[model samples]
Every structure is written in structure tokens, then in C-alpha cells.
Target: MLNGVSGAGEKPRVLTGDRPTGRLHLGHLVGSLRARVALQESHEVFVLVADVQGLTDHFERPGVLRRHIPEVMLDYLSVGLDPAKVTFVQQSGVPELAELTMYLLNLVTVSKLRQNPTVKTEVAQKGFGAAVPAGFFIYPVAQAADITAFGAQVVPVGEDQLPMLELTREVARRFNLLYGGEVLRAPQALLSASPRLPGLDGNAKMGKSLGNAAYLSDTQAELRRKIMGMFTDPAHLRASDPGRVEGNPVFTYLDAFDPDVARVQALKEHYRAGGLGDVVVKKHLLDTLEAELGPIRERRVGYAQDPQAVMKLLRDGTARGREVAAGTLTRVRAALF
Candidate 1:
């Protein structure tokens, strides 16, 4: 559908979406939203409010998801995702995508699904072990359906997500080869431009579930608390002792948010040389992050005040998305029989 309108010319379509499980955090902004905004400048971008996928894991708490949908949209808009440039879709609203996922399941094997590293890691994290739900297990097939249903050729993902996109490509390739035509478009991963930020606890990932993330909508009081408590060099017993930055979340936050590259580098050197203390570095990071988050928080407040208007935006975008997805599904069905 974007074959004619995109400024990207011959480049494949761009698809990026987030599950509406909770409010987005700084990691989400740096690792995906900022890059997504830049990509929309030259690409045909589609961002899904992936409630269906959220339900795959949070089926136990339907109300939490229902509440988070508009909150996620507020985050998207507050971060400058112009609705005119990007098509924002709701996954559950488009019935055709679920149908496509059902059809795609025939192309993916259970063994192959079991081998997915992402799924394996998630299963272990959730402590599901051998009892992982059927819906959660085959969500990769659902992801493939999301890509192929829109004929999307470019998917923006983090490194840990490449395996999921590989599953999508395999599904598209196998479907076309076995069914006799290129009915499905195999999507390629466009690795995110920003590096992944660690949690406030210095964990490998920043997650709301882990209780270690500062939300985009965090107030000054909330952010100050999180930043001051942020993990640093545990062995740096005194202000005079040298502190390392390689794994320290304070400097990592500085690297991600601090605009003054020269200042950040100098501060890192000072910290390592025992001339700087953790409190000074954290206060600097706090100011830098506040400068960036302040405006976004203000914008989110305005949007959050108008819940009805925001709901209409989601409905309109989902309607537009169905048109494109339905067209692709029609082509897929025609190719099948």
C-alpha cells in the first residue's frame, strides 16, 4: 500500500510496534522510539499498539492491558511520532491479522518454535518451564503474520529480537515456496541505531516488571529517587577510591542521555582516576536526563488529559491499517487456492 507514497523509494516498508503492557521507559525511548521517529522521515512507517500480543502473556490480567493502551499512545505522541507520518494500528482491532496468524501456523513447526531463543529465554524468565501456554509458544507465528500481512520488508529490532525476525522470514519463505508464489514478503531486520540501556539495578535489561526502570512520565521527585539510587561501582568504598564505568548504570545513563559528549568523557576519566565521586556524577546525569524528559513529560500530561480524542486517534489509525492488511490478506488467500 505504501508502494507509491513513501519517500524511502525502493526501500522495504518499516514496521515497529510495542506491546501495551505498561508505560514506556527511557530504554524504550532511546532503543526504539527515537530511531523510529528518524526512520519515519524516509520510510513508510507502521507502529502497532500490539494488545493481542500482550494478551498472549498477560492473559491473566486483561484490565491492566486495557488501561495501558492509551498510555502507550501518549508516550508515542509525546515523543514526537507525528500521526500524519506514521500509521499507528491496534492489533486486536484487526481481525484479519489473527486469521493470517492462524494460516501461518501451518508453515511453522512446533520443534522450530521450541528452538526460538527469544521464546526459550522468555519462558525461563516467566518460570513457565514446560507449561508455557500454547498462545505464548506460537507468538512468533503471530509476529510473522503481523509482518507478512502488511507486506512489511523492514522490521526494526534489538539484537535479542533478530531470532524472532528470522522466524518471520522463514515462515514467509516456506509459505511462498510450498504454495507456489511470493504471496508473503520476507521482512529484514533493521538493527536499532541506539545501544540498549541497562536497568537502574545494572541488570542486562531495563524493564517495568523488574521495578528498576524510570518511566517516561516520571515526575522530578520520582526520577530523582531512581537516579540517586541507581547502581554504581559497588567496590568504590570511598569518594577518593577509583570507580569503574564499564558496567556502572550511572555512567551508562550518562552515555545514553547526556548531550555533552566531551563532558561525559571527561567525567568518566575523572571517575576512573579517583578524583570524582558517585554523587557528583549522578547529579550531572540527573540534570541531563531532566533536560530531555521535562518536555516529553509536559506533552504527555496534555495528551493524557484528553482521553476521548486519543481513543479516536487509535480507532482511526486501526481502521486505516485494516485497509492495507486486508488487501494483503486478499492476495494471500487468492494465492492459496
Candidate 2:
């Protein structure tokens, strides 16, 4: 758990989501998805399939999100995100979120959205410059609507999303203050303890658009191929030459996946001192990743066999989520009128 995050409490609600970009990869697991499975024991977790949010920047590809939503839902289930344990909310199903977003827009300013570190970084990455869409620019307000609609007090997210959660808190606080009542619950960010998992090519993050991510659905042969091609020290061309351990994606993956601390440490030292070939380290990484991802693959195959069943969870969850959002909206409208 990140410092300052709330501890376990009975019936505490949590809200978090992922855009229906594609199937999740190992990077998603290590960052925050794995922790969400455990969170069900102590919290009422609501995982949103954010198709509406995906349309913000991806509006150009209309059907892209529709095609990917099922795959993303499969990825969620394969990793043991039980619908019985956690509610899987489809963002588009609830009309209340959009209404709440409109209300929240009045509470926030354009400059505040511009100043959000996360949004600013994304704008630059997308190279939107002056051409940024109004919907994409106001994502924080939409995110705030997502959290407070469930009255979620905590949100489990990666470090990059901390700024967005902070914005959610501010919006909630401003609304409650102006209304002279607690119409919305202020949400806190619960970041994972695990450092972010890097991509195969050693990028700071793994993403579908980056073309460096290794998906959970990857086959054994595919895993071996990607790991073998992972970034390592270019200076250490020969097997006898000392390789740099820092920033090496293979070693980074080992640190996250390999359980034997002593063996991993030993391997790191060997590579630094000149005898560990890149192939040796990469092969070890492949073994460690397979150990973790193998069962997930099997479960995914089983769930994929019955596509309707996996999607049924999403549909049922959306119905349940709509009930919750409807309750919140009733209270919010009363506070307004």
C-alpha cells in the first residue's frame, strides 16, 4: 500500500477503471490489477470498463473500443477478478456519470485541468498541442464523476493516475462545500507497492500503443521471443564483458517476477562482473514470467471458450452499477434543486 492510503474497512467502496484499449499485459498486473483481487476481501470494489472514456482520444476509431471491450473483460476475468467478489461497471451503461460530469464541470476550471500533471503529460504524448479535444481536456471531471457516482472512498490506481484522483478529491470537496452538505464522497488514491513493470524494450511504461508490451495472452513461444529481444546493455557485446544491470528490462522483469531473491541477486552480480550472458539472464526471465503467466493463460482459454458467460458478468455488473449510480444521482439532484 502507498503511504497515507486508507486501511481495510468493512463495506468501504472503491472505484477504478481501464479504457477498453486492448487486452491487459503483465504491466497492468504488476502495477495495480493484481492488488484489486485482494482488495475484494476488505472493500466493495467497482471496476469500470471505461468505453466512454476511451472515446475521448480514440474518437477517430469508433468501432475500435467496441471490438476491444470483450477482450478487456476477458483479461479482467482470467486474472481472477470475480464478478461475485467485485462489481464490473460498464461506463457507457450508466447515464448518471455524464450528468455528474456536467455538474462537476462548473466546479473546476480550465486552468486547473491544464495544470494536472497526468493530463499534461498525456497531451504532449498524443501531440495534441492546440488541437486537443474539449472532451479529452476535461477528462479529470469525467474521472471525478466516475468516482463520486459510486460514492467510492478509495481508488486503486497506478502512480500516473494519482493526479487524476487528486482532481477527483478537489471536485468532491468543492461540491460538498458549496452545497453545504456531503453530497459526494472525497476519494483517495491507493497506489500499489510494486514498482511499475516496464516494457520489453525498457520503456518507462508498457502500453498497447507503444508496441513494446507483452500481453497476458501471449503464447510460450511468443513470450520467449519477446524476452529474448528485451533491452540490455549495448556496450556488453561479448559474453565475457561486464553488463549494466540498471535500466535493463530483463533484470527488471526478474526483480518483479522471480521469487528467489538470493538467486536473482546472484545473477545481477554475475552480469555486472562480466560472466552472465544476456541470453542466460533473458532465459531466466522467461522462466519466471512463464511461471506467473502460465495459469492465467489457461484460465483465459477456458473463459474464452464461453464468450457470452465472460461478457455476462460485465452486463450484470453494469445493471448493478446503474442501481448504485441511480441512488447517487437522486441525492445529487436533490442537493442541486
lDDT of 1 by residue, 1-337 (tens): 3422233445457888999999999999999999988988878788999999999889999898999998999999999898888889999999999999988999888999998999999999989988899999999999999888877878999899999999999888898888877678888889986788999999988997999899998999999999999889999878899889899989888888888899999999998999798889889999999998999999988888988998888899899889888987887788786
- Global CA lDDT of candidate 1, please? 0.88
Off-target runs (Cα >4 Å) in candidate 1 are: 1-12
lDDT of 2 by residue, 249-270 (tens): 8888888889999999999999
TM-score of candidate 2 to 2 decimals: 0.96
Q: Which ten contiguous residues of candidate 2 have the minimum total lDDT?
A: 1-10
Each model's TM-score, in the order given?
0.96, 0.96
lDDT scores of the candidates, listed in order: 0.88, 0.87
* Deviation in Å, model 1, residue 202 alpha carbon: 1.6
Clashing pairs in 2: none
Candidate 1 has its poorest 10 consecutive residues by lDDT at 1-10
